[model samples]
Structure formats: structure tokens, C-alpha cells
Target: MASIALVDDDRNILTSVSIALKSEGFTVRVYSDGETALKALAENPPDLAVLDIKMPRMDGMELLRRLRERTAVPVIFLTSKDDELDEALGLAMGADDYITKPFSQRLLIARIRAILRRTEARAEPEAPDEAQPAAEPIVRGRLSMDPARHRVSWNGQDVVLTVTEFLLLEVLAQRPGFVKTRDQLMDTAYQDDVYVDDRTIDSHIKRLRRKFRAVDPEFKAIETLYGVGYRFAEE
Candidate 1:
């Protein structure tokens, strides 16, 4: 069974989400504070994490920042209804997704399953003695993206990206010079009916560029079009 860690200051939220996830056959671990969650996560990482952004002591953002330093476990953040900035920041900080408070149990479960399915699908590898070769890694200019290995490099230096970032980049880079509107990117990167907005997608794109630029100062592979969307540079 895939394991999931739930971190929230509210016991009720933890209990409800844990019960729902457990009922669906997921191994769930609960933490009521960011400090405890951070420690537990460092000691024993879960397959996925659900974090509340307003927790005491460390807060979800700090915990996530710390988490990124160590592991690449997929994370889904929980935020208040009005905390759009927090949600965007969480996404830029490498969270896989975020859901607002008073969220539906069904929606939460659906998001969890969708994320897990994507991660699991990517984790599967071809048999060592297989005959056919794997698909070639997508290469654009000085950037390289390997879907099978889930790796990205710029100018021959490694650049880490969350799953969402990776997927978004792939969607654009695969079709260089083809402008993809925000709606198209959301449709490509997220499951059906996911409510990601333009600003959220922009934040992820910004983060992706920042990550690549850290390794290659002249990174200009991703381009923005005013009043439209973005595209990967053809050259």
C-alpha cells in the first residue's frame, strides 16, 4: 500500500482526511504540527504528503522549503479559501498541488489518487533485459529532460523540478515555439477539471525558469507572450 503523511494543526481535519484515505486502502500517518511533521518526514519519508499551510511552529511553507532540501516526495498543500498567494507560493516551492479549506472529501480523494497514479506510472521502469530501447530524452538547446528518469539538466548541470513543474515544462518543450495558453497547460499538466488558474501557472513557470537559470545564466528557453501564454524557444 502507498503511504501518505497528513500534517495539520486541526485534529478534526486530520481525523477526517485520515479516515477517508485509510478507507481507500492508503497507509496514513498524521502529524498535528509542522515541527513534528518535519522530523517524521526526515526520518521516514512517505510516498506523498498533505500539508496545512497555517500550522504553528514552522508553518507549511517552511516545512516544504525544508522538505525540498532532502526529498522529492509529492506534496499536496491545504490552504484557506482566501489564501491564493499561499497556494501559489506553495506550488512554486515545489508542491504538487493545493486545495482550499472546506474542501470536498471526494475532491480530495480524487486529487490524491490522480497524483499517486501519475507518480506510480512514472516510477515504473522497463525490464533490464528488454529488447527495445527507451524513448529518447527531450533535448532543447542546452536543456535536457528525461521523462523515464524524471531528470532535468541545463548546460550539463542538474536542475531539480517538482512533478508539476516537470510536466508543465515537458508540455511546452515538446512543442517548441508553439504557444500554449494557460488553459492548455492546465489541461496537459493536471487531471480533468482541476481548477488551476493563470497566476498559479505563471508562478510555476517563473519557478521553472529560476531553477534552470541557477545552472545556466543565459537560460531563455521559455518565453512569455503578452496577454497570451508561454512557449519554449524553438532555437
Candidate 2:
């Protein structure tokens, strides 16, 4: 069974979400603040986390910034504010999804299930014993992405990426010479039963390309396949 951690300062929200998740056959651990959640993750990470945006000890954005430094756990943010900047920032920082407060319990549960499904689907493919050596990290000039480490570093300095960005990059890198359709990328990267449009993906890719270019100008080689999707060209 997939185990998840729910972090929110509101005891009532935490209690309700815990009950909802349990009914869906998930094991849940609830925390009242981001501080405890962070400590728990450092101890033993859960498969997924649901975090509230505003908390007393530590806010969700700060927690997210910190989380990106170490792990790639899929997270869904719960925020009371309907600010677009916060939404974009949260996603850019690596959050999988955001739910505004007064959200439907059903919608939250559905989103969690979708995230969990995608997480399971994106698990690394097995390699043959000989192929194990072939699974070495991908280094394109100064850009290096290490699947084994779940880390991306440019100019020998790590670049903080959200879970979605990491997965998108992984999908592209795994297919060195081939372009991936948006649906294919979504299936491989998200792997959850979801439909992620080109815009959502483009924003992530744009950020990634920009970051890479900032570090190494020649890093814009991530080719957009016109009407298709994206490919990390070996060209």
C-alpha cells in the first residue's frame, strides 16, 4: 500500500484528509506543520505528500524550496490564496499540483490518486546486466543529469528542479535520439492517468532550457519537434 504524509496546521483539514485517503486504501501519516514534515521526510520519506501553503512554523513554499534540495517526492500544495504567482511559483518550484482552500474533498482525493498513479508509472525501467553500465549519467556539454542520483547539475553546481521538471527531463534524456509526443511524454514522465497540455509542459521546458542556457549558452539543443513534442537531440 502506498503511504502518504499530510501536513497542515489546521487540525480539522488534516483529520478530514486522513480519513478520505484511508478510505481510498492508502496509509497516511499526518503532521500539523511543515517543520515536523521535513524532519519526518529526512528520517523516512513517504511516497507522496499533501502540504498546506500557510503554516506557523514554516510555510509551504520554503518547505518546497528545501525539499527540492534532497528529494523528488510528488507533492500537492493546498493554498487559501488564489494568487496566480503563487501557483506558478509552486509549480516552478516542483510541486505537482495546487488546490485552493475550500477545495472539494472529492477533487483532492482524485488528484492524489492521479499523482500516485503517475509516480508509480514513472518508476525507472529495468536494465540488463550489461546495460547497467550503459545507464551512466547523461552529460551534454556542461549540463549533466544523473538518473541514479536523481540530480541535475550545471557547471558542477546543482540546479533545483521540481518533480515534474525532473521527470520531463528524464523522459527526454532516456530517448536520446527520438522526439516524444506530448502524450508520450505525459505517459512516461507523468505516467499517471492524466492529460497535461503543451502549455503546462512548455512552461516547464522553457524554464529548464532557460536554466541550462544560463549555465551554458549552447544548452538550447533541446529541440522542439514542431507539431510533435520535445527531444533532447544527439545532433
Candidate 3:
């Protein structure tokens, strides 16, 4: 059974979501604030975390920032309805996905399941086959990606990325100098049943670049094409 950590200030949300997730066979852990969640998360991480943006003590943004420093555990944010800024910021902070407030429990569950599925797929090992060759690490300029291990690095320095960000980068780096339209990237990162807008893709790309730049100030492998999409430069 997958374990889930739900961090929110609202008591009702903690109770209701915990019960719902438990009914779905998930081992649910609830935190009423981000500060408490952060400490517990570091000691014992969960399979995934669902965080609320507006909370006393420590906000979700701060919690996510701290979490990303240590663990790449998948995160899903809960934003207030119509809070586009919060949604974008959360995505840029390494959240795998987000659900707006007053969201259907069904939709929230679906999003959680989809992210978990992707995480599991990446960790699952392929069966040995003599004819089927093993997957090789992708190398482009200073970037290196090991799909089998879900690891990425730049200039020999490790860079942590969420599952969605990793998938988006893999698609773009697969074909250097090839532009991956927003629609194509969305399809690659998100499940067909889940819908995410163009802006979401843009935010993930921005975050990806920011991470790479942290390690290499002159990193310019990812290039943007006005009104077209994005591409990994041919190096």
C-alpha cells in the first residue's frame, strides 16, 4: 500500500481526506501545519505528499522548498479556487501537480493516483532479455540522464527533478535541436486522463532551467522558441 502525507490547516480537510484516502487503501498521515510536516517528512518520507498553500506557521511554498532540498518525493498542492499565481508558483517549486479548492474528491484522487503510477513506472525494473538491449543513459552536452535510475546531472553535478520535470526533460533531450510543442510535452508529462494547461508546462520548463542554472550559471542548453515551444540545443 502506498503511503501519503496530507498537510493542511483545516481540520475538516484533514479528517475528510484522510478517511477518503484510507478507504482507497492508502496509508494516510495528516499534519495540521507545514512546520510539523517538514520535520516528520525528513525523518520518514511518504510515497507522496499533498500540501495546502495557505497555512499558518509555515506556508506550503516554504515547506516544498525545504523538501526539494533533501527529497524528490512527489508533491501535489491544494490551491484556493482561482488562485492562478499560487498554482504556477507551486508548480515552479517542484510540485508534481495541483488541485484547486472545492475540488471534487474524485478529481483529487485521480491526480494522486496518476502521479503515483508514474513514479512506480520509473522505479520498476525491466525483466532481463538477451535480445532486448538495456536502456542507456542519455548524454547531451553537459546534461546526462539515466532513465533506468531516474537520475539527471549537469556538468557531472547531480540535479534533482520531480517525475514530471524529469519526463519533460527526457522528451526534449531525446532529440537535440527538435522543438517539442507545448501540447506534446503536456501529453508526455501528464496522463491522458488528466488535463493541464499550456501555462503549467511553461512553469515546469522555467523550473527546470532554474535548477540547471543553479549548478551551471552559463547553462543555456534549453532554448525557447517564440510562439512555438522549447528545444534542447544541439551541442
The root-mean-square deviation over C-alpha atoms between each candidate and the true structure, in angstroms, is 4.9, 5.8, 5.4
Measured against the true structure, the TM-scores of the candidates, in listed sequence, are 0.67, 0.62, 0.66
> How do the residues 1-235 of candidate 2 rate in per-residue lDDT, one tens digit apiece?
9888998999999888899889989899999988888988757878888888888989899888888788988888887754656766787688887777787776677677767765665574656763434347888665688765557987797766655677788788776878888877666544435555676577768877876776677776688988988998785
How many times do residue backbones clash in model 3? 0
What do the candidate models score in CA lDDT, each in turn?
Answer: 0.85, 0.77, 0.87
- Stretches off by above 4 angstroms in model 1 are 19-27, 34-46, 51-111, 122-135
Q: Best lDDT goes to which candidate? A: 3
Residues forming the 10-long window of minimal summed lDDT in candidate 1: 188-197
Give the Å shift of residue 213 in candidate 1: 2.9
Query: Please, what's the RMSD in Å of model 3?
Result: 5.4
Clashes of 2: 2
Residue pairs with backbone atoms closer than 3 Å in model 1 (clashes): none
Q: Using lDDT as the measure, what is the rank order of every candidate, best first? A: 3, 1, 2
